[model samples]
Target: MLFERLRTLPLRLLFSGSVALFPVSTWADTAAKVAPDIDLKEVAPVPRPEAKAPATADQEPSPDADEANPVPGEPEAEPAPEFVKTTRFSLLGSDVLPGTSTRLAWTPGIQIAGLSQPTPVLVVNGLHAGPTLCLTGAVHGDELNGIEIIRRTLYDLDPEKLSGRVVGIPIVNLPGFQEASRYLPDRRDLNRHFPGNPDGSLAERIAYSLFENIIRHCDMLVDIHTGSLKRTNLPQLRADMTNPEVAQFTRGFDRMAVVHSTGSDGMLRVAATRAGITTVTLEAGESHRIQEHQIEAGVNSLTSLMEKQDMISRMFEWGDPEPVYYESSWIRANHGGILFSEVDLGARVNKGEILGYVADPITNAQFPIHASADGRIIGMAVDQVVMAGFAAYHIGTEAEVPGE
Candidate 1:
């Protein structure tokens, strides 16, 4: 039963065991314009340090030091190389420049404004040129896991040793973040407002500004998120494995257990893909709460990614080289009542297993809910009262279909 359950579970891509975000493609294509190449130009490279002269053996041996210290023929310690660093280039029509590992809030150019409020972005620059990695968090606002993860990562990475640039935007939907809600103040899903309109609604303007100023600038991206308030999730990755380049990057996350769907509309990953950007999602913990392990995993995973980018030399030790994959789905409540989940995050469940039970607090009657397919329980609702058609739990397997 356990093995069968594992086979049916949906795969959630865990970013260091953390949760994951965006917009649809058509709109992004129209609104998210990359800064003109004129904004950047080649400059002279910095000179390297001169080599020191070799020491002469006969020059001097102190009678007392000869016995205590090593001979002059012994190799001397090498001098550390002096690295020339470049600053992050300013975005178009704006003079804002991000410091190494610092998060910056932005105000887009008139070309990007549907209205005028600062759009937030985080930037971490590398000492040398390489890929620019942009990570967007909390696009839905309620997905708090990414917000914390991006903040901590930006605060921790040292730019002096970085190989490529890293940009993090912890909360793109400032209004939604402020409300601690999923949708923006406009009551629209910011994720659905992708590649927004500078002349559109409040949400559209914000989305358009981000796409123009931030998303279009990066070569790679990782959007972070979490399960909704009522549910909890196990970590996993979501990527469009159909694209060879994206599949390669997706395989880089040593801990990712699954590769789920990315064909949906108005999703940031889909938009990025259409724009010829490599993007993926990382799912970690529940909404509105901090999970220490999840945070640690996210930071470490990103650092390891930095290492892979040759931005840094340090490596983090995680688990096995490969992870399982699964297709997943949510099980909605058939009846209205309080829920008592029998399975926890990462727990395996079989078809017909009593994964949880719904009870009417007033009537004190219980109704057991079963898994329709074999898989692991990646997410479950914490809220006891569930209305019919309301999602109660999420299940998935790590198995890849023959062609998927």
Candidate 2:
């Protein structure tokens, strides 16, 4: 019932920074241009203050008295500037000072027979103030690629040189993760419940707790995921370009294929956007396993995104930007048979190009699936036994990224 609490939360939850992004006319144009991978910038450590020599016994140690205790008449030293851009900020009920990082626990209210596990939240509060970017992975327990991406991105950061905060939740659904399943113990999809109902079901309650405690703290969010049901997707951004705010932030990613999607009801991206958080879903590789190439690609894009946000400065290679797909459709099997792919992921095809084929095992009947439009394959199922109308291939029609 308290789902709309984002608007009512303390104003401290709203963060600001000196570097605000300009409107993105095109997704590809949003990043700094590059051909071959090369480092152009570097992260510098914070300069330490010089240590003063020890004073002799005769020479009285003179510390700055005025700095320690100001006179009562002298205007109360401006009380930390009331939730301003920089200074020590409080999060998760503690003051998080600049140039520091900490681990916090997110414990659910209920503790019934090992069902509730307190998840660890990694926070890196930087030396300077900027937008807060949150990276979440494994909303689905079977998804392993994202878990590694979050770990590598957060661990590689140096808090002393960071400009903004990076909050990483490596795994959100612990119940599902522990069981190696995609849903909760009760078979509820955790990703489908967001900005959840406090008095609702188990999934809803957990969703509400996370959203209220951690999710709202972000200025921007990228929910990491992998293709479900044995499907694999190219590293891409799924965003609702319809929102002007959403379009502006999607420009931060490097070389990710942008797919326009508003997201389904109760999804984290949709709820966060409704609550005034700029959000998008990042999908890479397939579920239930980790691929090195996919993980590297994901990590690169994420770091590139951070640099574009000015959160951290570092030298890194930027790949050529991929195209934006305005429309996409899944090519399904027409007959019950074993499926085999003829084209690889990211392969371009003509309207009538054959993508894959389905063959009936008992009877010698083979059916080929063709592209309905001139586009590239963005997602597809792994070769396996299939029934009639199983989604076999997904193709996306390329289009120019929309301007502001």
On lDDT, the leading prediction is 2
Best by TM-score: 2
Q: Please provide TM-scores, in order, for all candidate models, with all chains considered together.
A: 0.72, 0.78
The per-prediction tally of clashing pairs is 41, 0
Writing each residue's lDDT as its tens digit, candidate 2 over 1-404 gives 34366356433332221212222233223222111111112332232222334457788634221011111232322122223323554455433545655554565453452343456566777778788998899889889999999988887887668898888888988778888898977789988999898689988988887888788888899899999998999889999988988887877788899999988998999999998889999999999898998899889888998998999998867777678898999988888899999999989999999888998889989999988999999999999999988888989999987762
lDDT of 1: 0.63
* Model 1 C-alpha lDDT per residue in residues 267-346, reported as the tens digit of each score: 78788888888888887888888888877767767766666666677656767654445477889888888888877887
**Which parts of model 1 are misplaced by more than 4 Å?**
1-88, 92-103, 108-117, 321-326, 400-404
User: Ten residues in a row with the worst lDDT in model 2?
Assistant: 31-40
For candidate 2, give the lDDT of residue 261. Answer: 93
